[model samples]
Target: MRINMKPEEAKDILSDMRDQHLCFLESSENKDEWKKKYLKEAWACDSGAKALEKQIPCKPEEYVPDFPYNIFSTQKCAKCGTPVIGKKISKYCSECGQKIDWGEE
Candidate 1:
């Protein structure tokens, strides 16, 4: 059995597949291994050269800053200066527990 889809539907499906492929590549420990898999999948989808060209060849590790030891141990909230005895993740005022809105700075 076969099914027919509109051109727009096909495009959407292809786009979603490409995004998934990109995500897989991004998570791969070894990019060379992922490259082979990506190419094979792209060929199966009959993707254009442009799509293959857009494939990322390298995966970057995300950066995370060290936890603020001073703040966590001090029992004070990082954002609101509230006394946080055991709440290490607390960001609100100690007494009122009001959140201190620190907008992207």
Candidate 2:
């Protein structure tokens, strides 16, 4: 089964489920059936998320991992202010064809 959701949204859902599980444990209720059900669902979601994170790439050479790590290193062009990703040592603006001083020399 596939769920349509962004990685961040999915991660948030997983976190909420984990908290619910913890709450169940603290309440000392009979959660055997619920545990059997939701635990498997949570595991499925978590595994699916991990698989997608590996499959979905984050540009030029970066493979972003979940939510927080999903952000890639980007630099703005000094001449055009266009954000460039996965390029830290660049000395030229790919957008406007202008020479960039990236302080690498």
lDDT, candidate 2, at 28? 50
| Model 2 lowest lDDT segment of ten | 54-63
lDDT of 1 by residue, 76-97 (tens): 4343344444332434454544
In candidate 2, how many clashes are counted?
Answer: 0
User: Candidate 1 — number of clashing residue pairs?
Assistant: 1
Candidate 1 lDDT score relative to the true structure: 0.50
lDDT at position 9, candidate 1: 60
After superposition, candidate 1 runs with Cα above 4 Å error: 39-105
Clashing pairs in 1: 82-94
Name the regions of candidate 2 deviating beyond 4 angstroms: 1-27, 58-105
Report the error of model 1 at residue 62, Å. Answer: 49
Each model's TM-score, in the order given?
Answer: 0.36, 0.36
